[model samples]
Target: MQEAFSQTKNASAVKNNYDRVAWFYDPLSRIVFRNAQIQAQQALIPYIPEHANILIAGGGTGGILEAIADQYPAGLRITYVEISEKMIRKAEKRFTGKNTVTFVHSAIEDYAAKSHFDVVITAFLFDNFTQEKADRIFQKLDKLLQPDGKWLFTDFHIDKKSSRSWKTWLLKSMYLFFKFFSEVEASQLPDTTSLFKKAGYHAIFTAFWYRKFIHSSIYQKP
Candidate 1:
C-alpha cells in the first residue's frame, strides 16, 4: 500500500517521463515486444468488418493501424486517438499522403465524438493505469461504442499457475524495468475480459500467445 502510494504521488513525474521518452519508445518497444505485436495483429484480423467505422485508442507508431488499413475493405474509416505529440508526429510521417484516417490529438478519456464506433481497438494502452483509473476508462469506453460494436484489446499477461511466488517477483522486476522508460503500473494485470464484463460487454473471442506472454481479447457490446 505504501509503495503504491509512493508511485502514485509521483504521477506527474511519470507523465513527463513518458513525454520525454516518447520519441524513442517505438523502436525500443518493437525490440522487446515484437512477437506480442504480431500476435495482436493476427487476433485482430478476423474481427474487421467491411465498411465499418473503427476507433483506435493510444495508437502509437500506427503499425496496427497500417496493418488494419491493408486488410480493411475500401471505404472503411478509422479514427486514431493518441496523447503524445511525439507519437502523433511519427504517425503523421508514417502515413504521409494517406487520407483514409483522422487523427485525434487527445487522450481517449477526453475525446468526445458524436458518432459511435463500430469497433473500438486499444493496443498497449490500458496497462498504464491503476485499477481505479482503468475502471473509469472502461465505463467511458462503453459509452463510446455502438450497441453491436466490439472492443479489441491486447496486453501482457502473467503465466498461469507458474509458481505464484516467482511470478510475483518477476512481475515486480519487469514493472520496474518498463517503468524506468514508460508509464506502466505494476498492478495492471491482464484485464481485457474483466474490464469488458464490468462495462456490460460479452466476451466473444480470445487468444493467448506464447504461454501468457500476451493476450488478445474481443468483446461484443450487446
Candidate 2:
C-alpha cells in the first residue's frame, strides 16, 4: 500500500538524518531557539495529571524529560520514543537512574503501543514531513491516545494574515536549510491545528512565541 511505503520511506529519512545530528542537536537547538524550546514543554507540564501514562514521540535529546523529572519526580509513567539511536542514548544518559521512564529507539510509525496513554507529547517533530505524511501520522497518533486524553504539541506556524512577511521568509529559509542538512521532506510547514481538529481534538490551551512564528497548544480528545 502507498501508506505503508510512505511510512517506511519517511522513517528511513528521519532515522538516517537524526542519527547524523544527534550529538549536536542540543547545542544547536539552544542556540537557535533559546529558551523557547524549554518554555514550550513547560507550557504542557501543568496540564499533565499525576499518575498519568504519557507518550513522548520524537522527544529529541531529553530536555522535556529532564523538565518532567524535575517537576514531578516519581508518579508518572512515560514512554519516550525516538528514531535515532544516538539521540535516545543521550536521553538515557540524561536520566540514568529514572525508574518511571522507558526509552524506545524506534520511529514513530513503527512504535506499537501496548496500551493507550493519557497524554501524548510531540515537540518539533511533525514538521519533518510533507502535509500528507504529517496527516497520516497524526491520525495514527490519535488512535494511540486514550479517550479524553490530551496531546501536547509545539511547532512553527505561519499565520498569513497576522504574521509579517519576514516571518514567512524566515520559515521558508529554515525549511530549506533543514531539507539540505537534515534530509527533511517538507518544504513548508503543515497546518497542524486543522489536522488536529479533523481528528476530533479541541485545543484547550494555546500560546504563541517569537511574534506568533511558533505555537504551543494542548489539545484534548472529547
Candidate 3:
C-alpha cells in the first residue's frame, strides 16, 4: 500500500512528519489556513446525494462524514480511508457513535471494497501528491467508481491571477512552510479536470472558492 508512496519522492517523509505532528493537526490546520476547510465543506454540501454510497479518501479527522451525516439521510453509507495511524485513532474517537461510517486505516490503493461507490469525495488531499502520483490516483479512482457515479473533490489551488494577490502569496508561503515540516510537496496541483477526463470521467460540475485558494470539481462516468 505504502510502497508506491514510499518510492515517490517525499511521500514517506511527509507521512512521517504528519505522524509526528498529528496531535496538533486540527488546531494548527484551522489557525494556519484560517477556516479555509470549513468554507470548502460548506461549498461541498450541495454536491452530495441523499442516497449516495460514498468513498472518502484521505479523510484525516473524519469531519466531512460528520457534515454528511448531519445533512444527508441516515441511509447513506460512507467508507472513510486515511493512511496516518494517529489520524485514524483520532477519527475513531471522533466518530465513535456514527454507525453509518466505516473506517479504513489504509491508503485508497490498499482498501478493497465490495462494490463500486456512487460518489467519491476527497477534501484537501489532492494537493499533497506529485503529478505522477496524482495521475496514478485518478487512474485508481476510475477503476473504483460505478457507472455514472460522481467524483467530487475539494483542495488547494495556486491563485496567481486572482484579484487577491497578497492572499494568494500568503497561502502559497504557508503551504511551503508546512511542506518543510510535513515533508509534503505544496506544488504540482494538476487541474484534476484534465486528469479525470483522461481517465474517462466527464465533467459534471465545478466550483472554486476565492478564485483558487479552495476549489471543488465534480465528474461523472458515462
Clash count, one per candidate = 0, 0, 0
| lDDT tens per residue, model 3, 1-222 | 011121123333434235656788889878867677766765666777766778888888766766665666466777777777667667766532343677776666556666789888888777777777777777787778888888878887664475367666666676686577666654546567678766677776667665456777777777
Which tens-of-lDDT digit does each residue in 85-174 have in candidate 1? 567666766532232677776667777775889988887777777778777878887788889898888876665566475545655765
Better of 2 and 3 by lDDT: 2
Per-candidate alpha-carbon RMSD to the true structure: 7.4, 5.2, 5.0
Cα deviation at 88, candidate 2, in Å, is 0.9
- Clashing pairs for model 1 are none
- Each candidate structure's TM-score, on Cα atoms with residue i matched to residue i, is 0.80, 0.88, 0.80
State which candidate has the highest TM-score: 2
lDDT of 1 at 162: 61
- Candidate 3 at residue 115, lDDT? 78
Model 2 C-alpha lDDT per residue in residues 1-222, reported as the tens digit of each score:
000111223444552257767788778777877888778778788899888899999887888887887777777888888877667777776742343777776778788777899999999888887889898889888999999999999998787784558877787887777677667788888778888877788999999877676789999997
lDDT of each: 0.67, 0.78, 0.68
- RMSD in angstroms between candidate 2 and the native structure over all alpha carbons: 5.2
